[model samples]
Target: MTLSRAESAADHDRTVVVGAGLAGLAAALKLAEAGKAVTLLESRRQLGGRASSFLDPSTQELVDNCQHVSMGCCTNLADFCDRVGISDQIEIHRILYFLDEQGHVSRMSAAPLPAPLHLAPSFLFLRFLRLGQKIQVARGMIALLARSADTPGESFLAWLRAKGQQDDTIERFWGLVLTSALNESIDRIDLHYARQVFVEGFLARGRAFRVEIPRTPLSEFYGPVLEASLRSRGVDLRTQTNVARVVFENARVAGVSLRTGETISAKNVILAVAPHHVASLIPEENRRQDDRFEGIERLESSPITSVHLWYDRPVMTYPHLVVVGRQVQWLFRRPAGNEGYVQAVISASRDLSARGAEEVLSIVRAETEELLPLARSATLKHHRVVTERRATFSVLPGVDRDRPSSDSSTAGLVLAGDYVQTGWPATMEGAVRGGYIAAGSVLGLSPAQSLVPSLQAEPTVRLLAWLAEYIFPTRKGTLG
Candidate 1:
């Protein structure tokens, strides 16, 4: 039963992955690992897509388009970073704080305790919520965690009303959490999606508090790391390569035609690009039966805006702050050494985008100064505005059904993107998960079973540790 070299080489499968974002890179890596010849095509000169960063021409310093943060449950993304050899570049914060425009501050420490109990003190002390509101919020959390069945994929606002939560509480606390987690307003977000956010980020024991933030620009973090990793694994990464149309024959993908009039056949082709671009690349006939592919048309998008400022002096001491009752949702103090650079992330920014750059910058500056009074005395160095008009699919009511599945009807074609249905919102985690799922589907592997091993172990360990701390509360004078 001796096989010849030609016979052995002929057994290898070839896969083409379009787009070089997190989802695309993840699929490409998995395929390569499975002994498939993979080629990744990216229209942009650099990778990371929306998460990319650039060097400021004036200061010659690296700056990301916006700041991104991840929690402990972001195992898939962390694993991808580890595989790419840059996991250490991310810093994890066990404790997070919120600062309002009036200089009021509330801190949430990752102190070990029972599931929701660990967060109770922080919730009670939150200046944004009144005493009665805190109790209502606690009851809401209890109800959410105790529920056995999934909520209907309807408006989160309606769900809150059904839970007996008042509108004032939703406006103060629930709305902020929903907006930050889903990147959509509470009135529009699906209840199930909102529940998933709370369950995964807060209720899942230690999973809630392990906040990981990028130390370098995302483009530098992901672009080079992924490019080098893929190339080393023998993947043909074609930058500036545009796929004109996906050619299909007899309900199967025949090949892809390039913009320059070239063609390459593949055993499988994964369409890992954004939702809006899917219709143009796929054929009309193939898209007809493929509900997942066609579902992209039903999904709407939300916008995210960022205001970057370089100051003559450091304006804030903290690395990040969550602001309530303000246009700015989150703020980050970038690593500029002696120089001062700050970035403000405006999530679910609708009205902010309608204003001109000067107006937007002015509002952000005024808010920043109001929150950080010391910034008023500091000299303004430079400012820049970055807006992602379609940053993510709107996670509004009934929109969840529109999210595309990883599997498509076309035999040789799969889909991957944050907007694709990964049982999560349009986030880095969602994007990475979609890539993993798409890769598994193309390679004929059970994604759920493959993911189970990693998912189960850590959560169990964290849960036990949390339980131990709860049963035996530490005394103030106790020493090691």
Candidate 2:
């Protein structure tokens, strides 16, 4: 039963997008908003991908993959949230609380000072880092500030050492920030992304470091709410539809084949799935010649462990706390919801990934009770540990050259994921950026056309940026 020429032409007019994760959804929404016919296919009924949430059958409670926080610097994520009308569901915190190994508390808030010195008052008063360590950190920042751009292939640790950063600064200060932001250790992260985290997230503006947390579970927002919103925009959102392989005709992407043996042809296709998944789905011939697609094999992944605990009573006063010298890197208080639920995040969890759930919970529970004063009084109820082995693609040294562009060599195909060359770490911001880039490529628009403008740089930070620019006049990479 051959389809008529008109029918085949109609099928070719459609645009099919694989993987309804953040990157895919963002691309779909943008295309739909632009009046393009779009179809999004997802393997799971739910959305959000790596930053997704799931329901526990026993307790019937919803849980997120981990605590996904958006810093004020994440402009694209904020823009996407605005588009989806979920921006209000996120709470932006101006102050960040941290506890040292000895359980000493410190608060990080912007001071009255402007720009580069805005956090000076708060940072100077931090009780954890010694005075000398602070001086050394400041000096390192100066070195980082004076330096020009760094190659994504260069090692972050090597750069830090060359900048005269001490072990204490790396441990107490740099380590804490890098591990959380990069989702990889300082030694494993690339210098370009690490410095971007500092230059954009920290030194750009006072509020750049402000943390944004969702008021409710991620499933509650990205699930029905987002699906309905996308549907309203005329997107053909298909859930529980797994794409088995990409169909090629005449050396171009003809469409995609589903596991159900159904094939949907399209004029344009965006492969938004993970890097590892792409090679399997792509045609063998395409894999053989395209070095970009072949390089997906070389990219490594890092894991994140999230421990959700139900306590008898409220355990923490702060919404979230950054922990130093502990296996649990970050603890987020979930608004005392449903019997005081708490989430602990361990980024780049190499050492702990091999441990069993019960064992990890036992060790983390004991440590949590000891660290927070309020936790000592609250009795532990139930705990569930969620571990994502390939939570994010590690932005390792010398890996940037291997990252594929949004527009691949394969005709009628584009790519979108946190792994794409989004010029950022594998955060929600990067995913959104990837989608925007892919959408732009599909629409034949400029790279900057679809991107949201970055938050404005303050006057104080502008001066420091000016000084840094003076050192390396060609280095004018600012926020956004």
Candidate 3:
């Protein structure tokens, strides 16, 4: 097609994607790549939404709301990074370091064993779990494997107790992993989605647990890069442009009205904001009638707390470490030097908000000193406490049924977000999946058309996957 004809074709497929979060960014990019004239709108001046950064006045550096990471299971997010030319800013960690309160360390990586057994070596050698506790944990895994993979009906806590999981095992092992992944306590997280994290991210693929840590501030990684790419590809991105309402005519989306009362006409629209923001944006006439839109209102939020600590000297040896037996869940070391900067993560940290920032920081500092000897003597240069009261949606039992699909009742309107029934938790992967699904919805394509293929198991791991199914017959459902 000629340049004019191509431009005309793009005009014919003009699409408006609201909220330049990961979902909106990915959807806009996918549509633009697919020959659509795409316009991305965000109410905020900066993009990346929850995964964004702010200029810290005290340190004069960009600060992320919290440290975010992608896993090998996040195929779509990886693809999005590669497409946006920012993949080099990400550093992948094939190993993880865990530290108990006593400062006992355990190095965890994929062992040479087959699929489900790849993590067996590290778990077996860990000093944290006694022999009896290990045995109990093994039994718990057996019980988890025996349970139904689909049709989640209860809390993961209930399932763990029924499996005879000890309180210590639950706290040190299952709770640590589950709380971090789901951003909610075991009592609130669904058994089905929790199982999906272990089975797909741990069992189905040996390397799926690898972490992708960003080397730069999230602000640099997302906003500037996306702006450049969108402009080059003729995609319009409007910052600080609040979409007031989804204008509909005859049960079809006519356009979107801005806060300034100007209406931008478009052939298609994708609602790509957080779940809480959905109800207000949709016309009252349509939301009350469609259960799918109303279901988003039923979803709730979970809080996360991150502590950024700057020390005058090196405190931690590893890039990151999981803290055992503490409210502080994980620690991430900023690159270049291990000494100067580090972050502490606490998922489902509503309780932390009740305590003042100084108290929280004091406790975190004490805990840090106990774990890393260097921290005791190191001069504390600076510290910042970041608490996102509603960092993500609480994945309560049966929330799977509550999420709406990308295609909506209004003919040209679609939905996209980490909360939009992506089968994955509210992570980078899920957001990217939602974006791809939304892009597909507007372009008359299936998810498979825009989404990267799911990562496959190694040859030996594939055999172990079959063995896993045979031993535990309940492994018969889709992995998100």
lDDT of each: 0.77, 0.83, 0.82
Q: Provide the global lDDT of candidate 1 against the true structure.
A: 0.77
Clashes of each: 0, 1, 1
> Judged by lDDT relative to the true structure, which candidate is superior, 2 or 3?
2
lDDT of 1 by residue, 1-480 (tens): 111224223233667899988899888888887778888899988888777887889888777878888887777888888887888888887777888656888888755666546766666677877799988887666555433314546677876786678988898789987787778887888767876777667766655556788877888778676688889988889999998887776778756778988776766789889889999998787788787765689889998999998879988888788888888888888754734777888988899998899999999999888887778999879988998889989988777678877876778888898987677788888888888889999878766833412333234434543453443332322211
lDDT of 3 by residue, 82-174 (tens): 888889889889887888877888887888877668888988888677898888877666445443544475677776775568788888788
Q: On a 0 to 1 TM-score scale, where does candidate 2 land against the true structure?
A: 0.95
Each candidate's root-mean-square deviation in Å?
A: 7.2, 3.0, 4.1
Candidate 2: residue 149 lDDT (0-100): 48
Residue 281 CA displacement from its true place in model 3, Å: 1.4
Screening candidate 1 with a backbone cut-off below 3 angstroms (N, C-alpha, C), the clashing residue pairs are none
Model 1 TM: 0.90
Off-target runs (Cα >4 Å) in candidate 3 are: 1-12, 142-147, 458-480
Note the residue pairs that clash in candidate 3: 314-339
Q: Any idea what lDDT model 3 has? A: 0.82
